[model samples]
Each structure stands twice: as structure tokens, then as C-alpha cells.
Target: MTVLILGGTSEAVALDQLLADQAPEIRAVVSLAGHTSDPKPLNLPVRVGGFGGIEGLRHYLIENRVVAVVDATHPFAAIMPFHAEAACKAENVPLIAIRRESWKPRPGDRWRSVPDISAAVETLGKPPRRVFLTVGRLELPAFADAPQHHYLVRVIEPIGDRLPLNGVKVIQQRGPFEADEEEDLMRREGIEILVSKNSGGPATVGKLTAARRLGLPVIMVERPPKPDVATVDHIDQVLPWLVAQGIFVTERGV
Candidate 1:
């Protein structure tokens, strides 16, 4: 059996590791979108770049003889799910989506949830005097319309490319940031507002806590919905489900 994982996020890495350890007999391949600087290395076969479109993906699946596809991509990765659904259907290949649940506002957390980035930008109301943008490099263009505000943008990789806005200050840094450091940065930069995607995980949750501590409002953009497919939130659940579906033999019985 051959399995292909549409990967990019940390969860994707975990899923890949789980699959390899539990089902070494099944060949696994992970496809990355090539948007990150230091993507986690996988022990399995890896492919980088888009599959062009639905037809292109169908061709790849057919050629590779991929029996199952696991869409373990970022929740915010909207288009890939649509393509995966279409391609898998056309090729008669089984598909599953592994998505992490979105984060919810806790007690004392000030959050304004928006459906999308454009809505988030509009919800900012008047231009904030100082803003912290943690939305990543791919979606930075959405803030171009809010050029009136001074933005302190943080990204994992250095952006050698020019941004559409001129009033932006770039901070090239990796994540897993500390809450204390996040608070200090916001204070020193005089940030009154925060703009971020509701990417639920602990590595980047420090900024949200920092914003809440300083009473700063966060314009949180909700993740895009996944396409029609069997989906699971945890690796253990997915492994059992896959075995039940005959994608792999149950380890205990086998």
C-alpha cells in the first residue's frame, strides 16, 4: 500500500512519523508546498511544489499508484483541500483530512473573530497606531490595504521580496516564542492591536496570551473549512480508522 500526505505544518510531521513507525510496510510520501524556510525533514519520500491543478494531481496519483491520500496540511491551506477532493474522486483514490481544531477564546481573552483575512482587516476599524502582524508571509498582502497603520510583522524566514506596503517593519524570527518575550516586544513597539490567524497550537499561542495580558484586541482570522472527505483530529484515531478501512492490516492481529 502507498500513502501520500499533503504536509507542511508540525502536525503533518507528527502524522508522518506515526505512519512510518506503525506501518513501515506501507510506502509513505509527504508533499510540501515549499512555503516555509526550515520545514521538518521526513524519513519518507518527499515532494515539494504544487500539483498544478486537479488534473495534474489526478495524473500524479494515477502515475504514483497512490492508494490513499492524507491531507495533513495547514488548516488555513484552503485551495489544496478542494484540489485533493476533486483529484481523489476523479482517480477513485481514498482521501482523508487530518485537521487540528481551531482555538477558542478563553476567559479574559479579548478576541474579535472574522471569517477571513479581508474581514479581519476591516474589523480593525480605524487604523491602529501600532500593530503586530503574526499572519505569516503568504497572507501578508492582505495588510497592504491597511498601510495607514505601522505594522511590526514577524516571519520565520527573511523576506527578501518587497512588500506592497511601505509602512511595515519586518522581524525575521522563528516560532515557539516565550510569553514574556512576546509581552516585552509588544510593549517596546507600542502595539495597540494584534492581527493573527487562529492557528490552534501551543508553539504560537504565546502571542495570544501576551495580547490578552496587555488588553490588546486580536483580529483573529478563522481557518477555512476542509473539503468533503473522511477526517480525523488525532493520529491514534486516524491509524485505527485506516486499519478498519483496509488501507493497512491491523498490527495486533497481523
Candidate 2:
């Protein structure tokens, strides 16, 4: 059986690796959105770029004989999941979503949750003097109208083009950053407000802690609902499930 993974996030990478290691008999392919400058290498075969749309994805699945699809894209990757769901349904292919759990406010955490970026912006009230934007490059456009605030935007890749906001400062960096570093950055930048997606992972959790420590209000955009599919939160759960479904004979280390 062949499996196609709609991928980009670290969870996708881990899932691909786990599948390869545990189910070598099953052909696995990772599909990247090609939005990042330097995406991590995958252990299995990969396909980059959008699958056009639902129709295109269905065509690819039919042509490639992909029996199953594992959507491990970013939680806020709204359109891709919709496309995947439609394509899989049309093609009659089994589908699953590996969604990372959203982060909740802890005992000391001060978070202002909003359903979307627009709502978050509204909740911010007036323009903050100094804002740390941890939202990805794609969502930066939403903040263009809020140009009165000085933005310290951090991204994994260097933004080649100028942002719509005049006072935007870009920082190109990957995560798993230390809490101390985040705190120091907040201090140095004189950040009074933080805007971030509630992307729950160790890589970027430091920012949340930093915001809490400095008593800065964070406009946390809530994650979207996972696509309708058999879902799992961890890689270990997937292998056994696949085996039970007769997708693989036994665990074959990749």
C-alpha cells in the first residue's frame, strides 16, 4: 500500500520517519508545500508543491495508486486540509489526520485566545508600541493595516520582499529556542504585545513563556479543526493502526 503525507511541519517529518522505520513494505511519500527556504530532508520519497486543487490531488492519487493519505500539515493550514478531504472523498481513498494538540493556558500563562488572526488583531485594541509577531509569513498580510505598531516578525525563512507594514523588522530563524533567549529578546525589543499562532510544540513554546514572564498580553490565534479523518496525535499510534488495517505485514525498520 502506498501512503501520501501532506507535510511541512515537524510532526509530518516525524510521522514520515516513523512510517518508514516501522512499515518499510508500505510506500510512503511526503508532500511539501514548498513555502520554506530550507525544509528538513525526509527519509522517504517526497513531492513538493501544491496538488493544484482537489481535482489535481485526486488525479495524483489515482495515477500514483496511493491507497491512503496522512495529512500532517500545519494546524492553521486551512485550505490544504479542505482540499485533501475533498480529494480523498472523491477518490474513495482512506485518509487520516495527524494533528498536534493545541496548547492550553497553564496556571501562570496569560493568553488571550482568538478564533482567527483578524479576531486577534481586534482583541489587541489599539496599536501596540512594540509587537512581536511569531505568526508565519503568509499571515503577515493581515497585520498590514495595523502598521502603526513596530513589528518584530520572526520567520524560518528570510522574507525577500518587503512587508506591507512600514515599521516591520524581520528575523529569520528556526525554533526550539530557549526561554531565556526569548525573554532576552522581549526585553531588548521592548515588546509590549505578542501575536502568535497556538502552535503547540517545544520548538516555539519558549515565546509563550517569555510573554508570560514579561507580563505581556499575547494574542494567540486558535488552531482550526482537523480535517475529517481517522486522526492520531503521535507516531507510535499510527504504525499499529496501519498494521491492523492490513497496510503492512510487520514493522520493517527503514
Candidate 3:
């Protein structure tokens, strides 16, 4: 039997390794959205680019004889989850969403949670303050409203001349970032405020730790709605789901 993993996040990468090691019999094929120019390759066989949409995904599941799907995309990549559920249902394939735990406000974490990007823009307010914008390459147009603030944007790809904010610096990098490094970057930049989506993973969660330590006010954009599906927080949970579906003979020591 085969399993499809919709991957772009670190959890997805980790899950790929776990499945390869634990469930050797099940052929696991990972699908990437191909939004980024270069995505870190996984050890397991991977296919880049989209599945065309819901119809394409459904067809892929049926054609591939997929036994299960694990939606391990970003928390804010909302639309994909709905499509995963639909495709799985149509193909009679079991689906599990590998959703990471959301970042909660820890002690000294001054968070101003906003409904969406527009609200986050409003919460950022006016009059120039150095800002650390960790929201990535999504809707940067919203930040153009608060252009007065000196913005330091972190993205996986180069934003180039297309960034909407006037005074801005872009860091083309990915993470597994050290908390000390994050704190130092925030300190050296003279950042007074932090703007980020609640991506909720250890890779980018260092920013939250830095914000709390620095006592900076964080304008956190809340996550979009995810489809109501069987969701698991950790990659290990996927092993059990595969076993439950009779895809795997038994769970190996993980």
C-alpha cells in the first residue's frame, strides 16, 4: 500500500523519515506545492508541484492506490487541508492532518492576537518603530500601510524590489534557528515590535522566545480555519494511523 504526504513543513520532513524507518513496506510519496524555488529534499521519494487542485488530488489518490494521506502543510495553508479531506473521502482513503501545536502566550510574552493580516496591520499602529516582520512572502501589500516603520522581513526567497514596505530589509533564509541568534538579530536591529503569524513550530518559534525575552510587543496574526479532520500534533501519531488502517503490519520501536 502507498501513503501520500502533503509536505512543506519540518514536521512533514521528519514524518517522512519516521515512515521510511518504521513502515518499510509502505511506499511513501511526498508532494510539494512548488511555491518555493528550492525546497529541502527529503530522503523519501518526493514529487514537487501541486496536484492541480481537489480534482487532481482525487485522481492522484485513486491512480496511486493511496491508502492514506497526511496533510502536514503549514498551519496557515488553510485551503490545502480542505482539499485533502475531500480527496481522501472521494478515494475512500484515510486522511490525517499533522497539525503542530499552536504557540500559547508564555509568561512575559506580550502578544496582541489579531484575526488576520489587516487586523495585524491595524495593531502595528503608526509612527516609525523598528519592526521584525517574520510573516514571510504572503500578502506583503498589507504592510505597505505601515510603511513608516523600518521593516526587517524574513523570507525563504529573496523579496527583491517587490516588497511593499518602503524602508525594508529582507533575509532570504530558512530555519531550525537558535534562540540566541534570534535574540541577537532582534537586538542588533533595534527592533521594538515583532510581526509574525502563529506558525507554531520549533523551527520559527524562536522568534516568539526572543520577543518574550526582549519584552517586545508581538502583533501575532491568528491561524485560518482548518477543516475538521482527524488531526495529530506529532509525527509519531502517524505510525498508529497507518497501523489502524491495516497499511502497516505493526509499529516498530520509534
* Runs off by more than 4 Å, candidate 3: 251-254
Model 3 quality (TM-score):
0.94
Error of model 1, residue 132, in angstroms: 0.5
In candidate 3, where is summed lDDT lowest over 10 consecutive residues?
245-254
| Pairs that clash in candidate 3 | none
Candidates sorted by TM-score, best first: 3, 2, 1
lDDT of 2 at 191: 92
**Residue-wise C-alpha lDDT for candidate 3, range 1-254, written one tens digit per residue:** 57899999989889888877866777999988887888886778888887889999998988888888999998889788999988888878899998888889998999999989999878877778898888877667778877788988889987755566567888888887888899999999999999989888778888888889989999989899999999899998888877788777673522
Q: Give per-model TM-scores.
A: 0.92, 0.93, 0.94
Who wins the lDDT comparison?
3
Total backbone clashes of candidate 3, pairs 3 or more residues apart or in separate chains: 0
CA displacement after TM-score superposition, residue 251 of candidate 2 (Å):
6.0
Candidate 2 lDDT over 1-254, as tens digits, reads: 57898899888888877876766667889999999858998899988898889999999999999888888888889899989999999999878888788888877677888999889767767745788989888787777767678989999877656466677888988888999999999999899999999888788998988888988888899987756678888767777766666676663621
Q: For residues 1-254, could you state the per-residue lDDT of candidate 1 as single tens digits?
A: 57888998887888878877877888889999988857867878899999999999999998898988889888899899999999999989888888787888988788988999899778877745688989888777777777788889999877665356776899988778889999999999999999999988778899988998999988999988777788888767777766766878874853
| Candidate 2 clashing pairs, residues 3+ apart or interchain | 176-203
